[model samples]
Target: MTRGNRILLSCIYWAFVLYVFVPLLLMILMGFKDSKFIGFPIKSWTLDWYLGVFSDAEVVSTLTYSVVIAVLSTLISVVVGTWIAVLLEGRKFLGRAAIFGLTILPALVPGIISAIAFRIYARLLGIEPGMGAIIWAHAVHNVPFVALVVMARLSTLPKSQIEAARDLGADPIIAFLRITLPYLIPAVLGASIFCLLLSFDDFVRSFFLGGYEPTLPVLIFAKLRSGMSPEINAIATVALVLTAAIGIWAERFTRRTNKDAKP
Candidate 1:
């Protein structure tokens, strides 16, 4: 903790902050531009682009579609991932290592590769490209993250709680329901928010697996093909603000839940 080192670290942190926020600020600014195109030197500004987002039925529908997909996928991933985490957390099963590796393999795969693989798998299973396909892909991709978070939380859980429940004649399911599930709530909520953002922001999988109707990201990409506009910036900025708000709320809520859950 030398003065010189502190200054260097401070500079680095500010530089990183600038790198992230500068683009976001610019994007938000561009959304207010009065022109149809995106560029520098905004001679005029208006809220029309932002207003158009809500006024346009297509945009509203696509946004709703994206939210639905994210919610469905998050639910599936949370249930499946939490179960996997609970099963493997302190177990010594014969196939535990293999199962753990397979569970997380989807997260390791590159997005394009995962998307393409899912496309093929969905076709093979006779699953049409649409909501179900997108949800399936998103849930599979999100499972590893959920499992990792839940596993970390499970690691911090006191073994005494489960043992005490069992000693009271609670069965395995009852012990888990009364003791383990409550303890895992904060982690599950955090992971659900993370997965929701991931699924909503996802483009590649949604693109390949989507049908005639587009998700928000897919709709954005389609609009990009026509060329960038202030409208697109407005759309992205709105989505960014919503996701950031959710993340901040989830962080505070999870922190509060952790405090309340503490004995």
Candidate 2:
């Protein structure tokens, strides 16, 4: 690219980044403001909102529930998705395309529609709308993502490795555990983190599935309806920081693993 074109591209990229993050920056700034409402031109700054957010029993309980659900659902999705990917690898069977299409259909479907369907399904199954329902729903939605990532990883793996292991007297399970699983660890972890973040940030599915109970996103939505407050801002800031930290850690770990795998 020419120097002028490169500069134009750089400017456009930075402008997009600013557009995306400016509101978040403003929100974080509002968290530290002493004003009663979320507004610009901060008169003063204090940590009272942060303190209040941490001290509120409702906030604490809701956050704890969200964290638990996101973690558990992500873990379950990763395990089940990995197994599914392994089973489907190198298979040339009838309905393979249909199976893959069905697996990812949930992701392509509108979230609100999925939420409504899940609500009706839960009701028909006599399941109460709560943490249990939310976790299951989130896990179902995340499984396809995990499966796709894992399948891609498996595709790149050398078939000879597993074949050689089998030739050396290893059973199917033993060969998979010893040879295939190791190569998939990084992709699995990356996909797990993606699932966790998706579940954590979800609003509509959690709203329908949680019913009386509320996750952090649901709580934020409720609070927004009432009116913006520094307490909400404080909670959002903490959540943002936690998510960023986890994402950075996941990326670093994946990069290190990839480097170690290099010949």
Candidate 3:
């Protein structure tokens, strides 16, 4: 590459990085501020805000609710998505491509649009909002993403291994268990994590579908109506740190697993 192109690429990359992380860095800084309000020129540093994050009963309850929904939906999404991927991989049937497109379309839809659509449908059908509704919404939203990721990994696997095993008199189920499931493990796990995080962080569907109890995002929105507080900053900072830590761990784990698989 030319030096001019190199410089251009470097500039673009750093710009994108700054676009994503600069605000997050600011939030982290605000979390440690001594003041109760969010602002520039932070005067002093303190951990008092973080210490108070759990003291709020509503926030804690909503956080737990979010965790429950995220976990339940992730499990459902991963199982259903993996099954769909397994069935569709390198297979053709009438309307197969249409089904594939439909599944993927949900992930591409704006969350608020999907949430509103589900809300209208649910009300029409008289399905009251609750944990089940929120979990169903989240699972439906996340399935396509999990399917796409798993399908991509599935495509890279050679077809001959399964065929060879079947040709050697092993049952289809046995061959799949011994060959296919083993190969798909990493992709399945990574997709599960993706689904978990997506469901956990989702706001729109949860906001609309949740009943009696609100999730963390919904709670955050309610609190933000009064403007950003030190407690909010603390929560944001903790979330950022945890997300970054998990991302780094997942990347390292993937790398190590891939490296160990090599001869």
Candidate 4:
């Protein structure tokens, strides 16, 4: 491209980066402010809020609760999504298009709309608003993402591997277990991390389906009602750090696994 075009693109990239990260930087800075209120001209800073997050039994328990929900939902999504992906990938059958569309419909729907639908469906099914409901909703929402990732990996898998396994007198199940599953590990791990972050960060569904106990997001939302404070900022900052760390780790691990899996 032209030099002017390159310069313009570079400027735009930096502008976009600033736009995205400035707010996050400000939030993290506010978390360190010592004042009770949230604003500029912070003359002091303290770790009380950060420390309180760990000391507060409620926050600790809510975090643990969120982690449990994310884990359960990710497991459910991985199994169901991988199975559907295997069934549909490179296979033509009656109603295959319909099935594929239905599988991914949850991901395509807007979050608020999907959450409302799940809430209504739960009530109609006599399912109480609680952990089970949240897990089910999150798993449904996450399955499409898992399926897409797994299918992408599956597309790259060598057909010869499956044929070779069969030629060795391996049954379909044995071939899948010995070859397909191993090949899909990187995709599965990546999808699991993605689903974990999505479930942990979810707010709307948890809000609509949660029982007496709240997830971390729900607890944060509840705190927001009182008003924004440094404490809230600290909570959000901690969560941001955690999710970012997980994402970075997943990226690196997936890349390494892909390299290792290569011939």
Candidate 5:
């Protein structure tokens, strides 16, 4: 492409980014607004809304719940997903496609449908819908995503290295730990971050599963049902900033590690 065309493409890309971010920018601006109602173009600036967000005990608890669930779900998803990916990629067996399909089916299904199904399933299991249910639901959805990412990374790996490790008297577990796991680290981290963000940001799943202890998204939904507030904007702005930071850090870490691993 010509330089002018490239410049035009870059401008177009930035325009698309701005289109997506305009609402977030507006929310951040509204968070500082002194006005009672959330509106465009701030009348005055103040930190009272942010302070109010921090002071609200319910909000604090909801945020805490979100963080805890997200962290736990991410950890579980990463381990299980990575293991499934390794198994699928490293070995061939009968009904492999069926196993893989079942693993990823949760992600393919609509969130509402998955949530409803899990709610019913949990009820049948005598498990009260709560944090545990939400964690498991989020992990179920995240596992497929993590598996796909890690499997892609595994697909690109040098099979000979794994074979060599095994040939050199390394057991299956040792060969995997030494050879396969190192290569999967970046992908695993990337998937874990995605899982964390997904679990934290999810509303439908949390709503169906969260009977008493509300996640941040469910709390935001409840607050919205009553009325819009600048405090909501403040909370949203903080969540957006934190999620963005996590995403950027995860991307950078994955890229840096992959680059450093190049032969």
Candidate 6:
């Protein structure tokens, strides 16, 4: 209520914002600067770095690989995860808790650990690491997240609708398609976007499971280790812009959903 309190709150909010965004902002700026190395006092500005991104066939292919995997993984995670949530939430069965925990274990485990596990599993199955392996890892990693999101939405939903549908001569399948699936549509969509981003930006798992084909993040890491290249900054700038845009859209959707849920 006091002016001092308001000023303090404003300061804290700005500080948090800067802490989160300043690094990203710097990377983007460095992308445009003419300097070969990322440092202060950018002497010039250029769009050449961005053009380099399109000019390099390797970069283009890497980006394409990232998008393909992200989309495939997102689709798999959404369908499977929505089902997992619908089954597990508010249900009692033997070993239910353990199943739930195991389903979400990939999300809790470190990326390096998951990568190592995937490598071993792939070798055992006689499947080499490549697009398929990366896609599988990504899907497994995203399922728990999508399930958690959908389950949270489901928790706020009433079971009576499905019951009424069943009572009115509808089978379980029809009731689900008509009553349950429709209700969970928004959550499923939001979770898809979330999972897509997770897959797109993933580095460690993709690095290990990618095999001969490298994703965008893998390319970026290689560039970093190789030498100073403004192209890395340009790619990072694009990634940050896309990530921020998706994050903002997700936040807006959440706020709107909350508002709609209000009585």
TM-scores of the models, in the order given: 0.96, 0.96, 0.91, 0.97, 0.93, 0.93
Off by over 4 Å in 5: 1-12
**How many clashing pairs per prediction, in order?**
0, 0, 0, 0, 0, 0
For residues 23-91, write the lDDT of model 3, one tens digit per residue.
888888888889877898887889888888868777677778888898999999999999899888899
Off by over 4 Å in 1: 259-263
- Give the worst 10-residue stretch by lDDT in candidate 4: 254-263
Better of 2 and 6 by TM-score: 2
Better of 1 and 5 by TM-score: 1
Name model 6 segments beyond 4 Å from true.
1-6
lDDT against the true structure, each candidate: 0.95, 0.91, 0.84, 0.95, 0.89, 0.89
lDDT string for model 4 (1-263, tens) is 99999999999999999999999999999999999989998999899999988998998999999999999999999999999999999889999999999999999999899999999999999889999999999999999999999999999999999999999999999999999999998999999999999999999999999999999999999999989999999888888999999999999999999889788
**Candidate 2 deviant stretches above 4 angstroms:** none
Worst 10 residues of 2 by lDDT: 83-92
> Which scores higher on lDDT, 1 or 2?
1
lDDT of 2 by residue, 1-263 (tens): 89999999999999999999999999899999998877878999999999998899998999899999999999999998898788777898998888888878888989999999888888988889998899988998999999999999899898999889999999998988889998998899899999999999999999998968799999999998998889889999988988889899988998898888777
Name the runs in model 3 displaced over 4 angstroms. 1-5, 124-126, 260-263
CA shift of 102, model 1, Å: 0.6
Kindly list the per-residue Cα lDDT of model 5 for residues 108-137, writing each as its tens digit.
999889999989998888878888999988
| Model 6, span 143-219: residue lDDT tens | 99999999998887788888899899999999989988887887998899899899999999899988888988888
User: Best to worst by lDDT, what's the order?
Assistant: 4, 1, 2, 5, 6, 3
